[model samples]
Target: MNKVSKELKTGVLLVNLGTPDSPSVPDVRKYLREFLWDERVLDIPAVPRWLLVNAIIAPFRSPKSAKVYRELWTENGSPLKIYGLANERDLQTKLGDQYIVKLAMRYQNPSIQSKLDEFQTSGIKDLIVIPLFPHYASASTGSVYQKVMEIVSKWLVIPEIKIVNNFYDYPKFIAGFAANARKHMENFDYEHFLFSYHGIPERQITKGDCHNVCKFGTCCDNITEKNQHCYRAQCFETTRLLVKELGLKEGTYTTSFQSRLGKTPWIKPYSDDVIKEFGKKGIKSVLAFSPAFVSDCLETTIEVGDEYKELFEEYGGEKWDLVESLNDSENWVNLLEELVLENSHQK
Candidate 1:
């Protein structure tokens, strides 16, 4: 190895699914309008897309989603923004001044373009991009990659980029999730554990089908060789790992998807429907986990925390608890440091 006088500037970029700028309806409308209308996200044509998003989806969905965001917003702001800032700070501390850590949202404020510019201006030559989606989807991780490439295309000097697609199988990542769930379980008497993740439209899933695999039934059943990159498979993989870590028995726990938009089919079983079923089945106490998201966001905080809580309670369930996301947890920060080092070595 040659020793050089210049320090190799490496950037650690943390990307999340994103949230509205505020809890207001208009802001949520803007956020969703962009998020749902993405060709990569919806995987649909433009004409029906415009009608679906603007005329029907945005008009009704925004106000309802905004109310959910209101429940999630704190005095500071969205929990996603709050925890994203904290995660960046903690990762910076763990990385020990050798790397620059920048956080951005896939949908809204502090966009990928602006963050990459900040990193480029600061002389970062090597980059580690970690999309906070624990399970990778073309719509999520691939979208981030597209945005990064789009921005870097304009820059005079392009940094070498390494993307962390999914940490679903990472030991430390699994441990952080198990530990968080265990902490909440200690206080609450929960009879069932539910893992709920953001739902991507089924059309989006098929576009990345890789082969004829991932028919969304027995197709996603096997998370092995050919279908490993499948987003649905990875979500199941996360559940299996967490279940093993927590010593959970089969049928005692289940997984589902949340936050479906428009009339099209999304990956399922849906979280809202599952909660109702639990109530009908006499499952009294339940604990919900949103492992798809590494950091607490509007989806986990409001969609799972507040909205699901109300649904569970309304249906006569006894106790419902949502596990806190890995927001600046020591294990998470250390895991991130390891991820950066591993990727840098690979380069």
Candidate 2:
């Protein structure tokens, strides 16, 4: 009797937005140029966009942003990369010995192409690509898919691939986020819980409008099939789930967007404005959460943690606490593991 050969296996790819290789001006410039110039990111004509990015933004902003990133950088390097590696390790552990788990940055080093090559070379038959963005956006999750497909399309042998666009409303994800919030809040006194997400240019939002439903407030206030893929709507949904899970009242918590670039109108209830509002309202203690990002990066670490903290204090608020990100937390790891396993079985 001929022996049947065992199949190689399935794998999971966890992709994050990414960070610069180092917290230096040149590195930040290089990273920003690639990130900002993407048609999906900028969503503008080439000449005006080129003039804006190359002539104006990168030259001036790179130096300032690099300083912020330097503060966020650890001895090991970028916190985003460090946490991403940890997530991959913990996820592999939870998924058991049967699955091959890998992590890749959507933008910088250890890129999607190189990691996908590793999977391809390892003879993976079924692949699941999970972009770490909790909410779907063309600039974030969709960009990852584009890069993944760009690489896989070139391979002589392409594996069956599955992409999870968003888990903003997933029960496991909601539970994990709430649990983390509760864990942190247990030890502190927070008068308010703020969900601060990364911002994308408003033009990007309107262009990728799977439905013409995102008017910023009226549309995202009510999530439905029409605006299901809408970035603004999904972010609101994430906040809603967490608020429900944590039993937070309407006035007790709020959501906002951060890290907007070029100033052309990104999502609103901007973090800066929110911080000022909190301070002005005499809300002394605040706990901020970055739901858009699963792993902490410069946006969450420096932008939210440092910049917003200072802003809050400057505006008269006392004791602003930015909740630590879900960086390989046991519950979060298990949540991701289950997500992968359940999706893998579906294939």
Candidate 3:
């Protein structure tokens, strides 16, 4: 390994799914406009996507979504952005003066373009980017990479860029989730455990199944060379690993996908249906975990924690506890440092 040089310091960019700069309707609308317009996210043809986003989704959903974001806003700010900033500070401290760490959002304020500009001025010729999604999805990790490259290509000097695409199966990741879940489980005798991950449209998975390998079936039950990048497969693999480490009993837990939008059929079993089924079965208690997210965003905090719990209770269930995300945890900090150091070696 070459000795670290102050002039050639590595810039570490930590990215997460963005939040509205404020919880106001106009801010949420602005955030949604940028987020939904991303080709990778909407994945539909440009004309219709533009029509749908501009004419329908953005305007109608914005005010209502603003209310939801209000529920997620913390004293400091949006929990997603707040925790992302904390992660940047902690990782910078942990990595010491040799590395410069900055946080960015794929959309909205503190954007990837702005962060890269700072790195450029700082004279960082080497970069390591980490998208905070555990599972690899075109809309999330891929979007971040595409945006970064698009920005840096205009510069005369392109840094040697390395992006940690996904870390769903990293040991430290699984361990961190397991530890968080155990903390919640200590309070109640959970009758069942549920692992719910954010859902993407089925077409997105099919489109990315480049090798003709994704069967939309048990083919994704195990990770292989063929389905390595399949988002659903990677999500299931994360659950498999975390379940093993937590010593969870088979049949006592189930994995489902959540947060379907405009529904052209997303990955199933849908989390709402899962909750209804548990209610029907008269299961009174459950511990839920959102393993795909590394931070407690609107998805984890409101969707899984609040909405799901309300639905479960409505269906005759008693206790529904959501395990918090791996936001700014010591394990996560260590994992980030290790990932950066390992990538530094590759250069």
Candidate 4:
């Protein structure tokens, strides 16, 4: 590291998708409006998006979504937010006093703009931004990058910024997940495994693929220059890395997409279908991994762990389990520290 780089104060900003402040219908409605209203998420004209979000989805879905959130919430608060705060504190300790660390949510309280305000006032000359999703997607990581850039563009004295958009295949990250899975493996000898990542629309995949190679088959078996930024390809790549690290056999495991919304042709091989197939095929035991997320939130905890478990069991499948997310683990903290130091020196 150069002397000048060492002297300038650097700020580390960690961000995640925001959650509803509470499980109440009004709170969930507010969160859904902000989340679905994002152009990148809904991908429609302003009028259609506004009408769909305000007039239809939020009003109709908010109450039911609020019910699910009620099941997922705990005494402390939202697990995603809880873990984000924990990661901020641990990463700060890991990096020591030389760097400043702050946590932000892309939508709700402690927003990206507000956190950047603190960095701007602190006279930081360099900043490192790490979005908490492992796999890169336009709705998640890309939205975060766009939000940060849009906010920072207005600052009078913008800092040099380095963004770690995604770390799907980072060594420590891969190991942390493998370790968690191993802990589950110690007790149960599961017969089949599912690597279920969050689903995005098909257009998002094609949008990132410049070479028109995202046929969603062997095209994602290996990452290439064309499919490098493709969300589907990256999800597959993350599964491949986890399989290699965990020594999971080819036929014994399946990579599928979950949390599909609106039924607009998301990536192929949906997770619920795969689970049913496993049950019909007489696979008695199963283990599920959600490597796309770093923290346990509504998607991982309730969606994957709770709802999917019920679906799997309804088909006569037995012993379904979801390997917990990294979620403020020591290795996860170490991974963030490494990302900050490594990127801080580069930009």
Candidate No. with top lDDT: 3
Provide TM-scores for the models: 0.92, 0.93, 0.97, 0.97
Q: Which candidate do you rate higher for lDDT, 2 or 3?
A: 3
Off by over 4 Å in 3: 1-6, 345-347
lDDT at 294, model 2: 77
Worst 10 residues of 2 by lDDT: 1-10
Better of 1 and 3 by lDDT: 3
lDDT of every model, 2 decimals:
0.85, 0.83, 0.91, 0.89
Model 1, position 223: C-alpha lDDT score = 82
Error of 4 at 246 (Å): 1.3
The stretch of ten residues in a row with the least summed lDDT in candidate 1 is 1-10
The alpha-carbon deviation from the true structure for residue 231 of candidate 2, after best TM-score superposition, in angstroms, is 0.9
Descending-lDDT candidate ranking: 3, 4, 1, 2
Q: Model 2 over residues 76-136: C-alpha lDDT tens digits?
A: 9988888889989888877775579999987778888889888988888689998988888
Question: Per-residue lDDT of 1-347 in model 1, one digit per residue for the tens?
Answer: 33441466688999987889998999999998989887778677899889888998888989988887887789999888888898899888877666889999988988887898789878876889998877788888888888888888888877788999888889999999899998987787678999998888888778776677777877666587878888888888888888999989889998899988768899999999999999899998899999888778777777798889999999989788899888878988888888888997423
Which residue pairs come into collision in candidate 1? Answer: none
Model 4 spans > 4 angstroms off: 1-7
What's the residue-level lDDT of 87 in candidate 1? 86
